[model samples]
Target: MLIIPAENAVNWKRPPWVTLGLIMTCLLVFLFYQGGDSRLLDRAVEQYLDDGLLELEAPVYEDYLSREIRLQGRSDRVYDLQAFQQAREGGEPFWLAVSLLSDPEFYQYMTDNRDLLLAPAQRADWLARRVPIQEELIGRLSAFRFGLVPARLDVYTLVTYQFLHGGWGHIIGNLLFLFLLGYTVEKALGPGRFLLAYLVCGVLSGLVYTGFSLGSQVPLVGASGSISGLMGMYVAIYGLRKIRFFYFIGFYFNYFRAPALALLPVWLGKEIYDYWFAGATGIAYMAHAGGLLAGAGLVWLLGKSWFQVRESFFEPDESALDDRFTTGYAQAMGSLERMEFELARHQFEALRQHYPGRLIVLEHLYQLARLRPDLPRFRELARELMAEAANHHQPERMVAVWQEYLAEGESFTPLEAEDHNRVLFASLRHNDLKAAEKAFERLRQLGNDVLTSEACRLLASEFDKRQMSGRARYYQQLMQA
Candidate 1:
């Protein structure tokens, strides 16, 4: 099962600069810096084997494991070192080599045992060869050098490791989650608070992972923990507000509305469960859980520190746009009521231009056009009004108005070819094929191929809808012509 937020559509006004910057930085570091890790590991492994270190270290590593198990008094059998030799011969010691390299405890063991394991004559050669391998593994690899290692914890690595990724799938998945959660969180917290929360969560997450994986040598990399922090912050900020969530279980997927805070427990439980039952999948689930807790804590603390969440930002923006259009429309209508013809025309014209298909705007503008019937503006308004009314399935009312308009001394002009499609379709729809042909002929007379083609297509569709197959075919041919 997987779940993600489907909150209010993001306001792109601020452009999610920090989130985008973080993503770009991770991508660049992975592409440029982590690319050569395979080659370096290969070279280091060859050096380890060719210098005859694997033969000497395998049994010693077995002994180290045995002693650790004994100290803990666990009855777990030591995984035999026979696989190490077999792995070497089969060309598959990459994981084994990685295991040894990442282990500060094992690295320490090898250094301490060097004198005991090697002869006086061989010590110089062993020392010379092994130092390069140490540098290659612990000092050179991007993860070891920069990523969070529990045994060898450093101040800088907690932050740095969030930027380093292991491979393609790792980086892509992390970045995707980051973008999905980050944009909304950034908008909620504002950039500075968001960045602070992000870093603090990442550091806290690393600390939590350190607590869980104490004495382990594996270097943890990637933004899952920090992104997990964003997840926690996301819910906490929204709190009880019901938000949409996109969830998929097996092949079934859909969106559901739920209180934002309610999901925190679900996410926390998932991480804990995965960490417990999934075995060593190499993912840092503990860190993710820790990040979630840390992020929520940070938001809680901020609330206590006089930081009020901007509640208005979390609202769905559906009505915001509608209100803007309606407000402008209301003011235009108000101007028309006060007998300000010029002001109303200017206002309605702006609204009509912005909202071309708006029926009310066409109705009012068609009425206003009579004030200036001598102008081409009158014909343009007539075309727009009739076409829009036709599309709205109110062609009968507009056809009666067309007759009244003709009675008022307005005549149809064949030279005016613009926006003739819907009018033609309307005429066809009203069963007045003569009117449809007259409009189509006007469109053709102007030699405006674009208008003529669209008019033909509209007529064809209307005819086709009425089961007029021969008429539809004729129009389709005209379209090709």
Candidate 2:
């Protein structure tokens, strides 16, 4: 449902107001879905802290409190307040733990259902538990392992782990990244391929997480792994394509556009820094790395031809039109020589339209028209060419025109043998035996050797076409002489 405006120049035809309104609406919707409610978010934090489910340290409390409201469902503020007070008095953190556990899920659900609710943080807790993975699904997918051992892929853990986020902020951040990257990768690779790549990257990410944090009880969740993969593929395919990003330094925010490929190194550097210096709270850097590699590798292997096909759209060559026209003309001529009359006719028609009013082109068109007797407008075109030839005054060109008319059984003034031979060869590029024979007879009477050899070669080609041994032998004798 997210529609990106076309790049480079804005469409002036669309009112600027309409475009601004749509951008504002989408921004508002995104913010609302990503835990943007102030009241509900405060309540969740206070409830958890009062119930002793979360430590009430200054920075930790601030961290929990700073998360955006992610839902607009019926507020349970009164119940949360009562539970917080009761748990505080009884020295029990049961409600606080529940709040902590449920907050992540609430944020995830809000992100999934952004279009349905406009109010911020209304149904946060309702959406937290609907994870999409299942044991039966993994079991079914396991059957395609070929000769590989049938190790189970923990479908329940896979499904539940995807939902068990570290915090509201974590869930919201991952979801936002997913929304931006997932749609673009899906569009480029198509749904089926994109889906396949997504699942593979996710599974590989999980494996990396398990390898690094073996036997750890901390629940790993969020869509970062898949988002990382999308980032990799995007960078690989769109190398220098610019992406605009918002950056915050202290209290100041700035927007900048950079090539997508540049972001890859920056991202990896941040991940490396975090892994070395930051305390481990079960955020799997290895998983993110693995997902990125998988995504990039898959695109490289499967999308080579796709890149070649789409390269024209990204960068067009000015000479391509002329090259295509020349190629089309050559193919048309080949078809004509092979006697593929229909194909030749179509190609010639395209050539005529492509490059209008060339003399050589007109001659070919007229010849093709004469061959296609059933063509509805063939006679009309022939008459037109004849009229054009009549008005043309150069004797050499006129002789060529008369020779063609004579070949077609039309009346024309007679010319000497040498003139006829010169015109015939000039008019026809691939002269066959019939035309050559007439030319040869005229040349023989005039004692001309210049065209004799060419005529004999044409006669030999005709004999070969008819499979006539006698005519072939006679041509061979003439050639030796």
For TM-score, the strongest prediction is: 1
What's the distance in Å from true for residue 232, model 2?
1.3
Candidate no. 2 TM-score: 0.36
**Model 1 score (lDDT):** 0.79
lDDT per residue for candidate 2 within 240-331, as digits (tens), equals 87765556677776667777677677766666666655543446777787677767766777677532214322432337866877798899
Q: TM-scores of all models?
A: 0.65, 0.36
lDDT of each: 0.79, 0.53
Clashes within 3 Å, all models in order: 0, 15
Deviation (Å) of 441 in candidate 2:
76
Q: Name model 2 segments beyond 4 Å from true.
A: 1-92, 95-156, 163-171, 240-246, 250-259, 280-282, 305-481
